[model samples]
Target chain A: MRQSRFGPKVAVAFSLALCWVLPIAAQVETEEWRFRPQLGLWFGPVTPVPGTHLTRILETSLGGGLFFRMNIPSNNLRFETGASYSYYTSPTIARLHSIPVYGALSYILPIHLPLTFQAKGGFGSNFLRNYPEGSRNWLPLGYLGFEASFPAGKVVNIGLRIDYYFVYEQHLRPPPNNPNYRLYNGHFLNFGLMVNFNLNR
Target chain B: MVKLRNILSFGALAVLGCTNELPLSDLLNNTMTLKLLGTYESNDPYGWLNLPVDDVITTSGVASSDPAIGGGSDLVNYVLNASTGLSVRPNDLKFYIDIAEIRIARGQGKAPGQPIPEYWSQFAISRQLLCSDYATAEPGRILQNCADQNGSSKLHEFFNGGFTYPAVDIEHGNYNHLGIYFRRFVTAPAVGFLGNGTFINATAPERTMVATFDNRSVYGMDVASLLQNNYGEAAAEPRMFPLQRKDLKLFVEAGHEPYVLEVRVFVKNNMMVHILQPAGGNAAVTYVAPIDWNTNHAYRDLFNGERQGGSLLMTARTYQPAKSGAIQFSAPATAGEYFGVTEAATMLTTPNMVLPLAATRGTNTRITNLPPGNYNVYRLCDKTRCSNASTPGGCDQAAGQDGYPETVAFCGQYTVSSGTTTNVPLALCSSACP
Candidate 1:
């Protein structure tokens, strides 16, 4: 089944309101409808980690994303979730360029002063142009990060961040050449910034 | 209970998704900078490929005596392969040479990025020599260095290939430095550099070798002191400000006012981001100015002149004549145009880096205005024209030096209301100047 953007189990806020007043309420809902679309970037080095010698990480990266944060009215804490599509490429020793598709998720905690902290994780896959086998590699599995969004305006959010990602393995078997070094497993230590939009507002 | 707990977690996650949702694809697309892959071989010292140039030479190794110098190979890997790439419509390439230094081949045994020893490096810094191990027809192979240097290392210098004007190519730095070269019609600095320099490639702090003294007010002009007195000026302060390269900021040192300082930035993506600052620490200095408004990459062109595998860098000054008997005025814009007398701002109409020539004050310097179009202008004081010039300058290439006499100053474009003549005062070259 195709995944619904809002997920499978969200009770409509109006339904929740009706449930509280209904003689026999069948739906379960608390009460809240909100959307804050924020655009921000993923700040991390391209390589799996800092010390890995074999794989040559291309460059540090940046991208934009949509952030929708729902808050319970009158509460300081907000339920946050988001997803973003980003692109990355690295040239193999054979001059092969591979592009990747990325996705992300997060939970946000907004403070009183234009600053918000978020914990985020995402997944992606690398696709090479012509390499038949080992062409598609899953993005390194685990990512744990924290980001602080600087609210530029009611609609715009600029962010500062620090993130770490872990690599599990390579998608392809080793290439025939000896000089080829693939980045299979490593840790990325990144300090970067981002800009995101508050969609619902 | 475990299954119920998992379901609850899933529900929590979905609820979170409702508000913070963003399309992953567009975010990446917006940040992805365009990169071009081509082999650039030059000895330009800065290995800067973006700034303005008068022309693009077709090939490298222009001659046999030329050194394995220009920008070092490391500079190329840094600017072209290392820095962030620029996102322009179409890309162009050039093999231009403005500075060349001859070096004793350190022996093929040396790998790329390996530093030449510090002591020997200075010998080459102050002087240019053939790879010491290589053979030379000139025997003693002594080369002419820039006139600024004073002592023994003097004979070791390389030739600067003076004034390669009407350069095979040129453009304006109206928007970005290379806009003068590649002609991006935009009127701002390159995008990828917007947030540069904040992060350093921790893997390597900048390499430190014996370069010219790093000063503040004088900028790197002190290298010229190798020619004059040691009245030493204070060091230029290091300022790391925001630029237009998209995601970076670099802290580079600079000089006094009136000199817009653009720095040559190299990233992993091989993009050229030029960061600018007004000549001095004038807090009021805010907007970026156009033309050689840079201070850092002065010696970059030297890398492209050598046989080294690095990118080349040339300052905005190459296309600009210095204050002299012939020309004492600065180019109208701080970011000088490419040899084509090109400006980054002018790219809006025609997307070409065609160079424009200069018109002097005296003599019926007639030029048939081609194509009935509006063109940004410039002027020259061809010293070779003055009869009183030291060599009675009349195209006596072997006997004459450069610049027009101060008496015959030439200026242009007094903002001529289009379809009109713009006469600028011209300076003639002086016999004392050289």
Candidate 2:
């Protein structure tokens, strides 16, 4: 069998979602979804592909983002939109600044206790800026991830979030004229702490 | 649930198939810098010497009386394999080559996700300009245009002999060999100052060194050989297509930029000397004396008369024009700290060869290539230090040179000749001279 590039990643995403939801299926159906507005902050490592120019020149530094989430009327369903910032610096002092804005459908797996879990999938555009060179472009990006949160108070929730992101970058310029340019399809994995405040509380 | 699983599987398979269309390396950070370094065998002084007509000869004091002298040679036989004179660096040096391609061979093991071994492959920085592109180009004309130290030339600078390429993509693997294909003709300016400060401004009759590759290496050729072989069609292609080196054992890893492709060319003992006789014929002499550029300001002063068949034959004195003379001086006095002691001593003059009037002590200072003329000398005496100059004596004598009178400032005048070096006497005295 020909191995798919995203075979392992899709399997992991599905398995995690199944593990968190299968046991709590009864809880998700018992109660109707209520409108809840949440503001969140997240920070974690931005890991590029292991053997890419990004990984070679840049560091696995922390990335941070702000997100807004609202539960829809559909049971265990929420619409999440967020903006993130990540930075990597090279040995030559060149820097890469990545900013991504995305919207995703998150499934809330409600359980009997205060603990809750969510599975998220999204597609967005990543704005990449290479410093010193001052070149910037927007690349197509997709990510699959899961988040686990616990209520801190009536208005605050804190937890950990991890995501596997894939970006497609293309170069159509012919060579000899532009010898240094090449195409890059980057893969990144991010994991960090997430703090969310319930705006509707 | 079934529909979601089917969609995820379809998306994963689609992405996998899409990625296989593009050629991708398993390793990243494979960018390597390639450098072409031209080095010399020894730091020996080398330059050119003219004959018959006494012209300006540029040398960095290459020849010395003793064969064992450091950075010099009594004689460096071109025919003798063991005799290699010092090959000094050439000032304003530039080399031009036409590179056809550069390729590398991979190891026997198969690359990741590949069925067969990734064998010999071409890099992204390959297939540069070819030699046949310059078939109609002339070295003499090209050198005249490109040899300027601070000038730009597309034909000379950008025709692909550039010494360094900073970003060459090499895949991750082990390499066994590297093949470089370039032209046979290597062009460079023949005129430059040698290590011993001998300047060879040979621009009129000959100006460039157009050398050909005799063997696999291009090291043994000197200025004489380059001059002799300076002819031939410029753009002619040779029989050999490429030059190669084997057993590189080069390993390129992913996420590393350590690989460097370096090519070194040796240039040593490159100067030549041609003896010119007044009687219209040349004679061989054993062991030529070391010519001093500083001492012998005049070229004609090197030899009194012609020597024929190993016998002294004095010819009539040929009247040569006056040559430029020079002035030699002892070292200057060190500047003493005078910050708080005296405000008037702020502009203290440190003596050097160029400023001969400001005399020094200990080391010898010489000013060469000065036109023959007459010059005057004067001095200024301060409380702490005295200066020998060509102006009226000024005094700040609260503490410096207290007893010295104004009359002592007139250190007498000296003349510079075409054949001799003027040794000006400069001294600091507290008392007036009788």
Candidate 3:
């Protein structure tokens, strides 16, 4: 991950570019409501528990959590935060799974059916189990993802997101069945499609 | 020599022009040119030129004087049979077995910038190698010999003749099992009920004669550990050398010079891959003897046969890649638990495939009748039965294969899409977008 020391610049550049191009989504006329539930997809790389065998194996990662965006009444910028539930299968960790809790800060890129990509990073944990001896694990995760939205009612919105996460942790697990050996580690990669009930647009 | 060199170079050169020619055949013949995506052999079109890094002999390598080829006792009157050291009821093998059915797919990994494809294809089949060398010289299993009564002529029907399932709901079918051929590891196999006579019913029973070898031969756990530690595990690509996780000249031996190795693999519509390390002692590569299907009235020996490794290695990477990274493991859990980082292995640990073996002509081994072309290779690992073949064995694709490690492993693909001198490095996998 040290190699990515320079990634922040490029990421920030792209984020800025999106920020300049998109205007804050016009406040949905849920005239009375102040909350917008967003349907979204969370994308990111997952770090299996250190010594996680399926850390790099191909995985089936699918997860989604609710997205809540609080509107800053006076400005175009809004505060966006959401917790996602993801289910992804690592090629090595064939059947077992990893779940993460994520929090994101977004710059609402504007358009009517607006599209926004969050430069979201958060802290989370992977509860790896079905193991002979269960172990507890959690790690810090950073995500650079994009979200696309389409038509919905005044306040309620539909969202789709693709996220790529950099799960910070070593990947390499001992053969779960026979812990005497080592297995591969597959990073967490997820594509989430969700329907959020927009409380505030 | 100079003239020959020029021909080789020119033969390799790609001509970039469209010309209106005489006849179509003549144009086609003149255009026997090719466009390849990988390295091609300048000397033999049938062989591939490796990515050599200077052939400066480092230490004048020591040759294995272990009879590199041809020298084994002629155990001609070979009665091929398999048996569990003890009579195992079908139920017993069930307790000791796990199965998987594989379906093959392909595609460019979904990355930031990759070609948006117009069409994609998926194949539902099992990846297992069934060495057809069941017949050598006379008095062999007539069925294994190409000339015998049940030889080559019968090969077609038996060789990947395309299996038929009793139901598409095969997800829960009995045919999904460790069948007569050990290579086919099916999911949810129905064992223990063989022709109404179960092994538990027998006073004292033994599965097959193969089981006798483990009892009779010198069991070597060190060898198994050495291989497991070194080779890691076998992915579906058998053309790979279990040692370096790359393709090196490899073969199975019977005796000094009398080596009969399985050099061919048959792909079938059956969606399962069974990697039985074979139930033998040396616990070595079991391409030595042909599988004995009739031993226990049930073609597939439940006790012996193939034992694969546990865990499957999928080709996906997300470790912030640097120009170069260390292959070592992380820290250890505690005492009694050995763990450390891995050194950079020969194979690339990246997700994109680096090598592929599409034909049986020349697999893993350096010598074979293969037409020259550009080829791609990669390092891949799949789930094998754990602790069921070797002292601590497990290698059944039916079981889940492990994930990729930090080591350098890769696969390749062919680019014969070019002109005449075809470059077809088939970097293939069991599934794509995985």
Candidate 4:
């Protein structure tokens, strides 16, 4: 597949976001009841299913996505939903992209410092872009993630997040008579940094 | 709080470092493998020989006129004066086998011995050079030989390996017969020289000719010229041959593992000869042999006799002791009226005129994943014409010229079992020529 021009650009943007937001986050105070909208970048390895002629040689790639979260009144849980896109690069010229739209319930851990750790779970639909024609277009997507966020300022914060995604489609399985018949699924991991805006603070 | 932080840390590490492995069972379960075995021969019926490269010289290197004729005439003598050094070697031949049709017979509303309707028309298989002499040779040499046999020094493989059909639907009734078709691979013509020449420049040069079995004057007519002018490109165009067999029986059962069909092809040597002697001692009479010594076989007779509607007869005054019984004679030394009778004769048993008795044999195995049941098989010569109404020219206009309205080559019934391999054997031999 042709090398995606989006990868390096995303990396440079993420690095710039981190450099600009970290020092400001260290000088900020904690905010409550704020809509924490996040712009993030992710880089990770992607392993394609064996025998998938389309993405047989894709092993790793870099991706990025934007997400938003809202803190519920008097609760440690945050409601989160976001959209993300990933690209798989391989020498077989198999161009593949994964786009997921998700909603999640994130629980904030009790901690003393300004940094907060959160665990999340979500469910959504992942639309595979640039896949081979006639294959399943969309798969049910499920995800689990963990993130650590620190206040950059009264309005801005810098955070790191790790998200694991699972996409599955019954139509992708082999025929019943074939010995290898099983559920067709993809497992992906995205880990990167996010810049958040405390909109209500 | 410390314990909860440790737990969260461990959970994050586990999710980020999860390992995913693909299932291997899907890769190996659906495909079947096939193996081929046997030997092949060229079986040139006309015994066309090959000339060594060293003996041949271009016409530009030789003088235009013959010194023996004394340069009195403008006719440049193109002579084929071969003496000894003649070798007979058949050129290697290779061809493809196309399994055009495969179906199982369903016994629905028909008698037990009746032919069944063809319900499956989705099977199409083609394997190249299944009958070759260099089946196990290197790829470079095999490709060169397949393209141009003249440049390769190694003997080509006539019978090679088998091929595999990864998937097939044999879920219905038993499949009993298979229809086999053979296609010729286009290659350069095999060429050879009859003899070396002694030009006035005191150099011996060789003349070249194609060693093809197609004799143009077989019916005392120039068929090649007629066909070329009338039919255009179809005169030398190659078409696939549908091989016919007498006894073929194969049975397949639904839900069986896989089945292997073994096919063996054989080509026989069918050369016949008849000699006619003189009626009286040295009378001034010319005799012509009957052309119908063999009903449909005349490849060799036309080659040795009158070539291109011209007589090869010669008149001689005196015969040299060494060349007394030779078929070809030199021009007489004295230019007076020679009263000897003109005789046209050829060594009927020369290697160039008679093909050596030989056979090419090969075995091919076809693997299919089909359900087991009792079924019958039949061979169709022309798939397009197999069902056409029989006319004066037979099905699809395939009769009349080449004897159409042909019967089924092989038909037999057998049963197939699921998960196990069934073997169906087919043997093909040449029909008698005379």
What is the DockQ for all candidates, taken in turn?
0.03, 0.03, 0.01, 0.05
Judged by DockQ cut-offs, the docking class of candidate 1 is incorrect
Q: Which regions of candidate 1 fall more than 4 Å away from where they truly are?
A: A1-48, A54-105, A109-113, A122-140, A170-183, A186-192, B1-434
- Chain A TM-score, each candidate: 0.50, 0.76, 0.54, 0.68
**Which lDDT tens digits does candidate 2 get at residues B1-434?**
99999998765544333222222221232345564422210011112212111112213222321112122222122111132322232222333344555556644433567632134454523333312122212432333212332223332322222245333355455666665555432433222222222223323212322244322222111222111111121223221233444534455544322334544222111111222222222221211111111111111112322111101000000011235455564443222101100012122132210112122111224444334556544332322222212111221222223111112233445676777887755452113322
True contacts kept of each: 0.00, 0.01, 0.00, 0.00
Q: How does residue B295 of candidate 3 score in lDDT?
A: 15
The digit string of per-residue lDDT tens for model 1 on B1-434 reads: 99999998755443322222121211111111111111110111112224221011001311111122123222222233323322221122111111122111212223556654411111112111111111111334321322222211221111111111111011112222121122011111111111121212324322111112111011011111111111121223111111112111111111110111222211111222222211222111001112211111211122211111112222221111111112213323111111121222342122111122222122223222212233343332222211111121121221221111211211222232224443433232212221
Answer with 2 or 3, whichever has the higher TM-score: 2
For each of the candidates, give the backbone clash count: 149, 20, 149, 39
**In model 2, where do residues sit more than 4 Å from their true spots?**
A1-32, A109-115, A171-176, A179-181, B1-36, B39-434
TM-score for the B chain of model 3: 0.21
Candidate 4 lDDT score at position A195:
75
After TM-score superposition, the amount by which residue B300's alpha carbon in candidate 3 deviates from its true location, in angstroms, is 24
Candidate 2 structure lDDT: 0.42
- Candidate 2 chain A, poorest ten consecutive residues by summed lDDT: A171-180
- Which order, best to worst by DockQ? 4, 1, 2, 3
lDDT per residue as tens, model 3, A1-201: 357876989999999876754443333343342543444334443333344434432244445555566555423445565556555443221233344455555655645435544444443333333211122244335655566665577654555666555544333232222222322223455556556565435
Runs in model 3 with CA error above 4 Å? A1-58, A72-77, A89-93, A110-123, A130-134, A171-186, B1-434
Q: Estimate each model's TM-score.
A: 0.25, 0.35, 0.28, 0.32
Candidate 4's error at B312, in angstroms?
43
